[model samples]
Target: MRILQLHVDFVEYLPVKKEIDDAEPLLKNEKELIEDTVVILTSIENGDDETLIEDFVKETLDYLKKIKCNSVLIYPYAHLSSSLEAPKSAFKLMTQLEDALRASTDTIVVRRAPFGWTKELGIKVKGHPLSENSRAIVKKNTERQPGTLVEVVSSKSDAIDNEGSVSSALAAEKDLKSNWYVLTVEGALIPYDGYKFKKSEINLENLFKYEILRKRTVEDQPPHVKLMRKLGLADYEPASDSGNMRFYPKGRLIKSLLEQFVTKKVSQYGGLEVETPIMYDSHHPSMESYFNRFPARQYNIKSDQKDLFLRFAACFGQFLMTKDFQISYKNLPLKLYELTRYSFRREKSGELVGLRRLRAFSMPDCHAFCQDINQAKIEFLKRLDLSVSVMEEIGITPEKDLEMAIRFTKEFYTNNKEFVQNLVSKIGKPVLVEMWDDRFFYFVLKWEFNFLDNSGKASALATDQIDIENGERYGITFIDESGNKKNPIILHNSPSGAIERVIFALLEKSAKMMKEGKTPYLPLWLMNTQVRIIPVRDEFIPKCAELLDQLKTNSIRADIDDREDTLSKKIREAETEWIHYTVIIGEKEVATNSISVRDRLKKSSYSTSIDELVKLIKEPMKGKPDLPINLPEYLSKRPRIAS
Candidate 1:
């Protein structure tokens, strides 16, 4: 079955004549109009039978919910498919689809056009990002030719074909035997299905549905997609691969600051920063072994008759480097850190949406080589704190903005129950726990903080893993005090999962605020233009420039709206741009040497001296990295990058 779904403002159709002998009886020959309806132009192809009714209805209902409309028009359009079902059979399935849809939802109004008829159709589709979609629904075929493409039914309403090489761990991830539980801070292990949730534990429940249940309803692009483009942060790069993004100047500035901040934080915690090549030889023994151990797809390249693949994480490079080092128990816990500028992961195409998930991303990967499990546990806690602190500094509060999930081998949890409980206690909440019967990957234990977005989807943010096999697998060893060389335990930590994902979380958070009738603004420290200076008249442009100079001298990012627009329009533009403070200069301000300021966050206007405004902006930015404005200081000189 094939369908073209559309959200239309109004659709009109007229049954002129019957195109087939099995056409349905028409009650009216006049034109019919339905306003604000979901139009599904469906085609029932050969082999499409009664089995498709349930899925078709469910997909229609999901689409209705996403578009916030209750009316649906299921039109039987034969042009959608080349090989159509027999007219009599197609009519029966079409009506069955209509009946199933109406029975599934009480509020939904389902309507259908006459099957096997030539009709004049008119539709004015909605202009939003998710107004139109195409889907192909087909039955499973167990047998196929050698070169045939594999078609996988998407978890969402649509269908997608699987591509790229699947790693052993990635395949194991789909079939990993696990028991799910909710581990409370008080050390109670409640079955995930039986645990009672509090009203405040909505995000926890969402994490359960995302991880254990594997349920996703919102198929359209997330709220952050629109916000990313509107706010001029980032956008899809059509010239590149699906998951690669083109960051605007503001986006680059934000990315740069986050990189600096995270690197500084890791260094403060005793991590020796290092650099590594972004690509590695695919035929290398260690690379080939490690690829199957990790659950990620690689971007393969052929260079000079040698096969090379992009690195998905810093672990391989750091592990290979450490394998060559000579160390003793005296240097038990050696930490190496790298802020990978472009870690490449060939994520499923359907999963590529804005900055939430990207093919190329910056990851702050830190590895700690430990002598034993005991040492690894202690370092893990410290790094967990570091993760929490880093996210908090980035304006994503843990336990509020993030939900904790801990995955471990059942044997590890059995021997180290207190250690596992300590982690939940540190989070101060009941966390989702997945315990496997056996270790499928190198990590014996791993925990991550996930941000549940406005949609029901959850994305992992800060994560760390305690790898018990990687050191031995890579031949990285340390000599103990007893003079025996042994493989050291490796702990992989990404304090901030990926810099691009952090921006996505911030934008998604802002979208939530907007939905709740609040003035959404970025963190003051991350704003590209901390303060926007607007001259009320052309004569006051010099005064605005002086104010900009003063702000620059104080290390505050300030830009002048020196365009020829009216004062109100300039102020509105500043607010739309999410500028933290808008300082309006005119005769009154020039006469008094004070400025009128509009704080976008506060949504109020006040008068303050330039020194006072500078101090106000600087206070919140004390510990954050500062960078000059990435765009032109004057508004007139700037190009319109975002619509």
Candidate 2:
């Protein structure tokens, strides 16, 4: 059983609908309000029985006494656990638990929200640290043997995270202390507070505040969330778990292009692309230890009495694969890349926003195995350049759209100060520095490029980590020149982070432009419809089709606006879709064998030949993937997916 306990000023709930066939009949389906109560949002999980009732009551009474509250309300909430008990059994247990709580203390009043009913909930929890807490109540095993398998769920909200297993690194990270600095291009580490900011350094300063203070909980949805839906990119999937999204056709096309581009860049950087499984055995020796090494809540599953877990990164599979291969130092600096279609991380419900953070996302992960630290350093810089180039080609420039942050232990900085300074000099800007007193994670040095949104939240994009562990942990060995087997140092690099986050950054950047009273636009290559060809008259429909054919021949995504609407309205709709160029076909254009084109970005219109229009559109698309339009060629045939 899992429970999220909240001490609220008042909890107001109304039964809106019955979610289960065995839903309890309510005396009154009106709003039920409880004041000055300890509300326990409960999820009854498998294997829970009367054995847990005593402990549950004891915990509840202790909490009430601690808070000096005499009132309690039990609310059945299903989202707290993926593994749920049967509805009938769960309802009975919930009622029995409530009865036990009431029978325990004469001075306390106990109430329960109707079970198995869909209800509208309103809660105002107090702002104290003890006001919110979660717990997983399991049947205690007194007769457990040595070396027996035991499943333990965590209770840390800010550290190890959630009910699932958390990494030891993440838990240590919570208590890790660091001194902040701004590393300049001239190789001086100025204290963060001592460094003065320039007008152009606003984003960097925002990144400092976001990282140093570590305020990641988002209060309101960012501007990109609305724009994502308004532009037909993606939306939250209500049918699935929170933080999982459904992408429309246009969004799919954009994601495909980005995945293709990032893969191509990695391949050119000597990475050998490979595929890996989405799930692994949690009881496996390597997985068991590695779980606490990297911090994230995982989705656990039970199959045939064996414990399994969904992967949050491509590291496990890739490392296991490399461990089985016979390699030598000649093959050192071996790079393996995988573009994971879906990596699962059970993020906190409160932090699950649009595409910025997700439970499942596509990640372009690449790992390089090196002979030693020197080789690792060389490969790290190469991957950094590759990441920078990839971002630049994707229209997100490092100097303008991103801020650099490098984190390391004090020992690393003291030993390799010049190497760290070179990284800042390479980016040609002052970077945020976090120098830890001790090493906690597998990586001794790490850096990432962050994009600051309008709400001052920093989202990491391109990143690389110089990991000194995991090789030996996974038992991967490469024969050295002296014929001795040695573990290789691994480097983890994600050139563009999650594909969904790239889209979020693009949308956020456009929203930022709109906020500045500038025209908002997507990169031409990413636009679903690069050009829209509209017919001025019914006779011009045939002419517009011919022009579209020409545009298609040159690999331009052009669509015909053949609907029976005024030419002005058609053009306005095209503008709303952010079509780069709108071509209108009419008598003047037909007679002269030319087209009247409206450029959305330039806000200019002029007559140009079909060849010139093709060249104009194709110029900026140089070296980029040429994908056909995702929607139909005629606008009239396309369904409205976005508002």
Candidate 3:
């Protein structure tokens, strides 16, 4: 399976509001046109009144319909501090706006915000009496006390001692400085005095300054900044090493191991490994459509009066390759894999973090074409098995270290809930299903393989999907035994999304495990430097060199540590690099023609001969290691495997 990094612009519909005393004249005036259109609303507040809110919303819907927009997304700006107290009229306006839009036009689609945003907005409204019957259920649930209310008990005469009496009487106070009570009704401790009652008045300014409002407002800033930061575009650093040699020696070793793993595993699965140009003609019909669909992710290049775009996915190239060859039923289940890098877009400036989201990164992309529906299912399952096997080799166990697929509900197509439900049902159970608001209708099944971090949060490591739309769009077809051609079912599956991302996950996971005094278990074969031959003394240097030579002959990733450092320090360094085995050459072992071997995790030593050590390492190396690694043999020898 090939991995991919796609930049997507999360388009949202925002309801705009403009208050005009003369509604009829404003509608006829072109200057008022700016106010009526829904071009991404900003600075929405809770306390906005009814008529102005309704008029703005109605005009925005009309403008959206006029523009022929298929989807109208209600993007909540509640993350902004200004949106804290959206006028009640805004809610009432939206209640009638949907039906009003439906009455006017059937073309435009509408949808609510993502659950994450919805949940956040709900939290903001907690303990708010004005927000008591708020549609946001999360906010209502968090309300401190629904029936209990707070009232202000203003000071009258200086001798009254109102502060002491109020504190003792009320369950809670809105503000201690300004006389306010948790209980709106007067109690025994603080009787309702005519002077204090007369002084108290319910006004918008005081209501907004309420303690609950202040607390919620203050708490909202950090999380909003964090979310915004996460949505920013990724940043790229120039390659420091010349000719891709900028990588540290250890990093190079790791890269080599990953390449080896991918070559062997993908080749074994009958996947035709290929490479394609990173840039493509922007005018190409397929690419043009893709750009329109995900503008934020695709990069455009101008040359010779023409536009070119960085290829966001390898599937298009693979599909284009298939057009050159005529295939029959016998040649069914064709799988194509490529290790390529492409540029993807990001919406926020701070979203980019290390290798997780990058403008350019390498992915192992596999596109499979099958003649029959069952064949497609079988291929997907096989891909899933391979993905799991690879991750396991790298010490990622499905049930323990990793959680494969998580399914959750998301608001689907705005206007066509039934269509979305029908589509989801037909696609079958996704490995990890979450209700996604921004997904295409044509793709049925979508599954993502996730790796749990130290915090137990799942990060997507790989993805698999069945695309029925792209097949028709790209005109990919196969000829059957009856000589009839039909559009082939296409499966876009990536076992490892990006090499940089997988490396990041491995680094984080390994570092955490080591900090906890745990040795990271890696499949013997995928280890960057499989064996580290450490000479106990200068006398054993020759023996170590000889052992290293023997290992190299057997294609074992072995190295010699001839550093002047102590054996213990050398061993510690080797362990830090996560080398699989450490072979220590001491006087006794050299004399006996055996070396003391220490496993990275065990940290316990045992004696083994040169031949025996090679044999031992060879066993695990015979099969594919879990994770994406490159085996030298596969690269040097392009085995003519059938797909």
Candidate 4:
């Protein structure tokens, strides 16, 4: 069966003459829905049975939930397929589908278009990403095709993938077996069954592994989600579709900082920055074939009567841009960068969370073209270092905030084992390495920096992939020393993964601190209000104003707490906002020409001069980008946010 799903603002239809003699009776001559709903354009194919109708309803409702559509309209769209069922069969299937949809879901409204009738449709699709998708659902136990793909395993041990069932995906693994061992901290390979775990490392053995979709046992409201909403950072948009969050002022500030920071790092590494379109024609010859090579699903739209798919990454734009560029071996390592406004992936409803994974999220994508395999490996290692540095800059150290994982094809590893060992040695941790006996997609080797939260959820923060196919696929070539045009190897890296996921990790880390009975705080540079001055009484307001002015002049984020609240209450409020420094000024401090500075992060207080405080804060903030405070300069002018 063929289906196209649409999350529409409204859809209007009017029935016309029946084209077939077995047409089902119409309940209404005209019908329309005024608000959010799902319009399923369905075609019952030649061999469809009652079981097909059952499966179709289940899948249809699943897509509806992802877009938050409760009501559904099952429109008989015979034009979607050329091999349609007989008119009688199609009519019966339509009736059965309508009844099944109502029975399977608690949602009250379910309607179907009059079968065998020509109808006019007026549809206004929602503006949000993932608002529409094209799907092809085949019956169970379909015939499988043969293909050759490489698979490799680290000589030591193998990782279990509950979500992907990698073992099954690679047919070659069926008859072959080897001794699996897990690598230790010192890079020693030990038998997986013989390895012992430390008390602190026990949970790593039982962690649930998934690539994109979230597991069923994942907590509904993890610590980060609660804290994010409470701090007025980001929240869900009920008016928009699910997985597309609405960021408040503070959240936007956080996202912007991370984006700018990573982009600057990429630029400093000799990257040529550019922007690209978000949509491309789905029927473009090369793109159509390229889409099949990718393992991701896409959001499809019919624009001006032409089929188009949203770009899942910066690949399509960058590849298309490079296709027509003039180049030489001298510029072999040509780097391209773009901070994607948003990328859309039709993730399952069960997988959508606060920010760990989203249907629409900002990403900093950088790609480089290398002259040969050697140059590509050189660039790959540099990106790996940058990935570590980015995590460290964000306060996620290798030992504390993140873990490492490397995947490579067996052919590549056999040829260059030393290079892989060097990476593991440099990081000085037990890295999880997976070897594939065959090639799965375009990349030969890839690695990720992951953050595992208390809920046993592991999220990849930074990643670099070595792509071996796209250069030729997109006709991107550079002239070599011999004057012959050669396709270049491409490297894809996100110094930091999705901007939202970075924020998610930061929030989750802070919450973990709170769980351990420690005060949680945002990174110093990201604090919305770095320093807040509180006057003990109305008379000391002038002193507070002077200090705030001096601090701002020195490029320190400072604000005056001018609200009519008690001194104790104000101090508590600053801490709650995760303000890095809170200063309480009074007669004694004003006369002494000093202030008592309360450090929310250090959980301590000390007497210091305005000059001394500025110098101290500057030490930790050196070389870091500064973002404007989303809140007002004076507390009195601001309204309460984040209930």
- Highest-scoring model, lDDT: 2
Roughly what TM-score does model 2 have, to 2 decimal places?
0.77
RMSD of 1: 15.3
- On lDDT, the stronger of 2 and 4 is 2
Computed on alpha carbons, the lDDT of every model, listed in order, comes to: 0.85, 0.87, 0.50, 0.77
Give the Å shift of residue 78 in candidate 2. Answer: 36
> Largest TM-score belongs to which candidate?
2
What are the per-residue Cα lDDT tens digits for candidate 3 across 437-511? 333334555656555444333456767776766777777777888999888888887776566566656655665
What are the runs in model 1 whose C-alpha is more than 4 Å off?
Answer: 1-175, 294-296
lDDT of 1 by residue, 336-446 (tens): 999998999887787788898999999999999999999999999999999999999999999699999999998999999999988989999899998998877679999
Off by over 4 Å in 3: 1-246, 342-349, 406-432, 435-439, 480-484, 521-523, 624-643
- Over 333-412, each residue of candidate 2 has an lDDT whose tens digit, in order, gives 89999999899998878878889999999999999999999999888889889999999999999989999999999999
lDDT of 4 by residue, 364-383 (tens): 89999999999998888888
Each prediction's TM-score versus the true structure: 0.74, 0.77, 0.58, 0.73
For each of the candidates, the C-alpha root-mean-square deviation to the true structure, in angstroms, is 15.3, 13.9, 19.7, 10.4
State which candidate, 1 or 2, has the greater TM-score.
Answer: 2
Instruction: lDDT for model 4, please.
Output: 0.77
Which portions of model 2 miss their true places by more than 4 Å? 1-175, 214-219
